[model samples]
Target: MNQDIIKSQWKQLKGEVKQKWARLTDDDLTLIEGKRDVLEGKIQERYGLARDKAEAEVRDFEQRLRKH
Candidate 1:
């Protein structure tokens, strides 16, 4: 998905994001605010994933969301 589209759809995506990454708190989502980099960083911090892994995860998530 495009970054702008992600940002625009953030409010709706938050619940799905939380479901995908249970470790993320609501505060985290607010802070992320649909910024891809921030989301990846939060996912890394919360899940102990490396930068590359986090990026890949986010990419996969975007792809999945695009499919739906």
Candidate 2:
């Protein structure tokens, strides 16, 4: 997605992100905000997943959001 579109949709996207990643604590989302890389790092640490897997998960989640 383009930066402008993502920026405009952040509020809704953020809520959806939190809902979809129920395993993520509020503190983790707060720290990451809209930064996808940071979110991936937290997912890796919390879920014990590989970096690439975490990134893929995040990407897939984002794609799902876009579809909806």
* Candidate 2 C-alpha lDDT tens digits along 1-68: 55566556766677777777778888887787667788889989988999999989988887876787
Top TM-score model: 1
Residue 6 lDDT, candidate 1, scale 0-100: 92
TM-score against truth, every candidate? 0.98, 0.78
Cα RMSD of all models vs. native, in order, equals 0.4, 1.9
The C-alpha lDDT values of all candidates are: 0.96, 0.78
Residue 56 C-alpha lDDT in model 2: 95
How much RMSD separates candidate 1 from the native structure? 0.4
Clash pairs, candidate 1, are none
